[model samples]
Target: MSAATTTEQTLARYYHLHARLYDATRWSFLFGRSDLQARIAALRSPQRILEIGCGTGRNLARLAHCFPAAQLIGLDLSADMLARARTHLRQHRSRVILRQQIYSQPLAPAPGFDLIVLSYCLSMINPGWEQVIRSARQDLMADGLMAVVDFHDTRWPAFRRWMAVNHVRMEGQLLPELQTHFQPLDSAVRRAYGGAWRYLRFIGTPRPIVHR
Candidate 1:
């Protein structure tokens, strides 16, 4: 199998057991989720929003409250994760659409989403993170926004390696990639747990596609 496929399988297997405990366990570490939602709500009232790797639909459900009139799509690769998401987001089912898939390419009839979100999942994507970012750009409308909140990097080697064991790579690479594909509207990296690690929040809109 290809490396991307391998990465997908790895994440699937990892979340299989973690999905049940995800919502309860993640609160301590998965910071900035509510803040990111608030930031996005304050900036735009997008008509359509797409969230990549919307694990357990935690953000999606909250987003439903944030933007009551917006259509929401929550895409995740793990069936187990999507299962939890379905149950967690059932109340908003009328407006929330959940899909089980990897975001390797633009969705059909591309450039349709007014807001795209990557929350605390991109860092775990291993070999496919950059491709996912590019694909998200294609799926974004010309005036649409892309919002991300994820691990930036850890200062301690041991902590970094520990996160890697959980399929996360926190080397501060995502921000630069986001800046390259979009025009940054708001971005910041802040320390966490007394400098043990840092996380970032990036909000941007797609840049004009240049042809060589």
Candidate 2:
């Protein structure tokens, strides 16, 4: 199996086991989610929004509320996660669409979404995170926005190792790549749990694609 496939399988199994507990436990550590959404709302009123790795639909529900007229799509690699998302977002069912798939490439019929979000999801995507970043650029409309909130890195080795076991790589890696593909609109890194770790929030527009 390819590295992406392997990572997907591992994440599927992980979420399958943890889906029930996810919403309950995540709020303690998953900082910047609400802030990220607020920042996105400040920037644009997107007509169509997509959230990659929209586990349990927490942000999807928020997006539905924030942009009531918008069409929302939540894509994930875990059925378990999407199943929870389905329940969590049922009130907005008419506007919300959930899909179970690993996002390795652009969705067909290019220039798809006005806003794409990744909330604490990219860190777990070890080998294929960069590919997903590029794919997000491709999937976006010419003036599309991409917003991300995720673990940045930790100073403690033990904490880093623990996160690694959970399939997250936190080494302050995602920001530079995101900057490379998108023009920065808003970006910041903040400490979590009194310096236990750091998390980043970024909102950017797709940089004009250069074709040779």
Candidate 3:
């Protein structure tokens, strides 16, 4: 299947059907979201924020708490997910915009967004996940920050091996794809504050090529 088609199918199968159960299961498999949140709180430029693959708006809700003054945009490919997000966000409807669309490309160029966050959303993409990260790097403003927290294979042999096999059997997923996707991006892997989960956070700002 083409990238677009696969994107559509993945959204429907995983996000649409799974969105209602997302936050319930989130703390189980998605362990490092708070690490992403801390990085988000530190951003100073482009005060507006965008969250790509914002499943069920859980992160958006927390982000609103952290940055109440920032305008929020949440986009997801799953209509069902958006439905739940919409309902949850009604109280803050004026402060939020939810779009049912894929983030395979850069969003309509907006000015001065302080931050764009992707929280545990990269593992599901079959391909072009790297491209999405790259596109986000380009779309950022000079001082804009991009914060991402996703699955990572810690350099431990036994636990790494166990998580790899366990995830596929349990959730039909694995982190190697995302590990490979982010390998070339300017980023680092830090141990999460909680006990077991390690976080992969990358920050990018537009760097102009200097003429010698």
Candidate 4:
């Protein structure tokens, strides 16, 4: 099997096992999610929003509250995870749509999203994280936002190795790559657990392509 396929299957299986415990367990370490939401709320009143790794839909639920008129889509890869998301987002079920798919390509009908969010997800996608970022740009409107909050890096090799086992790659790479595809409106990197690791929060619009 291709390395990417292996990575996808491994994560699907991992989430299948961890789906039930995700919302409960992720509360402590999934930092800056609510903060990101609040930041987005203050900055934009998007009519349509998409969360790339909506997981158990906790973020989606929050977005629904923050943007009552917004049409929201929660896109995830694992059925088990989306199943949990469905239950978690039951109150806003009518406005929220959930899909199980890898986000390698732009969504059809062209640049439909007003805002696209990547929350603690790009780190887990091994071989194709950059592609996902680029594709999300293609999936966004000319005037659109891309908001991200995710692991930045680790100073401890042991901690890094442990995270790798859990399917996360935190080498402080995502933010720079995101900047390549989007222009920064607001961005920050913060230390986690007394600098043992770091995480980034960013909100940006698509970088204009300069024709030569």
Candidate 5:
């Protein structure tokens, strides 16, 4: 294989090797994930839901349980991750589509989705998340729900902030180019652990469409 292909293969191997232990080891570091699940459940009318960075498809499986009839699509940059996800989703018996792609690229260009979720994703992508969000906005249907669950600057009590800072220092290196991308939308966060950590959730409502 070519050098680039070889490198990609090596990385995929590394991810697959670690995939089984990923949830147990690294899952707790991603806090406030339950909040995302709760909010998606409350949407009440989501039809087509898209999940970016769907590693191992655990969340997609959870979503299937939450909304039995909705169409689900998951995208990720690593084929190894997608493979694990497929295995987890094999018995769901729902229409779950998995795509191997990075969030830096445009979505499938299929107009839009009823619900779009970014859960602990931006902090691990290439330096184009803003572009990705713009693409998501364009790919959303009118009044669609965009839910984000991610680590934040964690403004809270003194001790919690210190812990958050340290945790970010450890894992944030993987996403060194990521910026605080939550300011534009009307956003709120639930702060805990002396305010050292928070989970941010934002929703945007596009202007209404008028039929000609």
Candidate 6:
């Protein structure tokens, strides 16, 4: 199996064991989720929103509240996570759609979405994260927005190693790649836990495709 495949399986297992604890435990450290949503809402009134790796539907629930008329899709690879998301987002069933799948390519046959979100998911994707970013560009409308809130990097080597064991890469890598494929409208990195680590929140529009 490829490295990406192994990583995907590993993450599925990890979330399977942790899905129930995710929402409760993650809030303490998974900073900037609400802030990211606010930043995106400030910039656009998206009618169709797609959130990749929407664990436990926390952000999906927020998106539903933020955009009352928006049709929302929350995609995750973990069945356990989706199960929790389904229940958590039950109230918004009319507007929210949940799917279980790895996102390495564009959604077929459907028109692009007005907004795409990745909340704390890109870092766990290991070898395929860059491809996911590129695929998101394809999944977006010409003037669509992409919003992300994720771990940026850490100052402590020990903390980095611990996060690696948990399948997260915190090396300040995502922003540069995001900038390459999208035009930044708003982006910032904030310190967490007194600067032991940092996380980023970004809102951007897809860069115009360049014809060769």
Number of clashes found in candidate 4: 0
Candidate 5: where is the Cα deviation over 4 Å? Answer: 1-17, 108-110, 154-186, 207-212
lDDT of 3 at 205: 55
lDDT score at residue 94, model 6, on the 0-100 scale = 96
Per-residue CA lDDT of model 6 for 62-126, tens digit only, reads: 99999999999999999999999998898999999899999999996444799999999999999
Lowest-scoring 10 consecutive residues by lDDT in candidate 3?
166-175
lDDT of candidate 5 over 1-212, digit per residue (tens): 55534544544566777777877786656776666677667655687888987888888888877888889999876777887898889977468989887655557575568778887765433335566676676667766776766665544456444644332222323222222322224456566566656555555444433347
- Candidate 2 regions with alpha-carbon error over 4 angstroms: none
**Model 1 alpha-carbon drift over 4 Å, by segment:** none
Q: List the residue pairs that clash in candidate 3.
A: 45-114, 46-113, 46-114
Alpha carbon lDDT at 33, candidate 2: 91
What tens-digit string does per-residue lDDT give for candidate 2 at 1-212? 88888888888999999999999998899999999988888889999999999989988999999999999999998988889899889999999999998889898757889999999989999898999999999999988899999999999999999999999999999999999999999999999989999999999999987788
Q: How well does each candidate superpose onto the true structure, as a TM-score?
A: 0.98, 0.97, 0.75, 0.97, 0.72, 0.97
Each candidate's number of clashing pairs is 0, 0, 3, 0, 6, 0
Shift of residue 30 alpha carbon in model 3, Å? 0.8
Give the Å error, residue 119, model 4. 0.6
lDDT of 3 at 93: 83
**What lDDT tens digits, residue by residue, belong to model 4 across residues 123-208?**
99999999999889888888899999999998999999999999999898898899998999889999878998999999999997
Error of 5 at 6 (Å): 14
Q: In model 3, which regions exceed 4 Å deviation?
A: 109-112, 154-198, 209-212
> For model 1, what is the C-alpha lDDT against the true structure?
0.91
